[model samples]
Target: MISLEHANRIVGATLEKGKALGLKPLTVAVLDAGGDLVAFARSDHSSAMRPQIAMGKAGGALALGVSSRTVGDMAADRPSFIASLGPISRHGVIPAAGGVLITDGNGTLLGAVGVTGDTSDNDESCALAGIESAGLKAKN
Candidate 1:
């Protein structure tokens, strides 16, 4: 489980990282292992769909047990399969690089963090930064 405190830290650090990199306005979502939203935030200028996109990224990672980057790769290799997941998944599966799974020191799954509103790589960097800032490990 991800405590609200850590979830908030992840959101803050993710946004801070985006700002530091001079990236576009970002939206972030943190989800627990069971794919439940723990915390979420969207920058003022973020697009309307950002909230759903962020949650999808995080939820997809949690559901698939892999980073969203890997999901993107899978989409490339198996488009139909990845696309099929969308209809069944509650948050939908977003095949992007912004979603990352979080773990503890001993490799216990904790939660996932997702970021958006910038390039996929940049979004992923922010997610990684946020996880690190919280002293958690990213299963990237």
Candidate 2:
């Protein structure tokens, strides 16, 4: 389980990293173990679609129990099967970077953090930083 406070901290850290790096404004999302949103933040000037993109990344990570980067690879290898997932994931799954799984010191899955509005690598890095800022490990 991920506490709301923890989610908030993660989002804050993720957004701060984007700002510090002078990247485009970002939308960050934190999800609980069950893939429900726990906290979210979108920076000003970010595209309207950013929130949905961020949520998709988080939900995709939670559903697969792996980083979205891995999902992206899987999708790339099997486009048809990945496309079939569309109906199942009402919130959608973005099989891309920027989504990372959150784990505890004991390697238990806590949740996930997703970042958008920057390059895939930067978004992923920011999400990892957010997880690290909360003293959690990112299973990416």
| Over 4 Å off, model 2 | none
- The local distance difference test score of each candidate is 0.93, 0.89
Model 2, 55-129: lDDT tens digits are 888888887778889989999999898778757985578989999999989999998888999999999989988
- Candidate 1: segments with Cα more than 4 A from true spot: none
Q: What is the lDDT of residue 89 in candidate 2?
A: 89
On a 0 to 1 TM-score scale, where does candidate 1 land against the true structure? 0.98
Q: Which residue pairs in candidate 1 collide?
A: none
lDDT of 1 at 34: 88
Q: Native-vs-model 2 lDDT?
A: 0.89
Name the top TM-score candidate.
Answer: 1
1-140 per-residue lDDT for model 1 (tens digits): 98999999999999999999999999999999988888999999787999999989998998899999999999999999999999899899999999999998889999999899999999999999999999999985
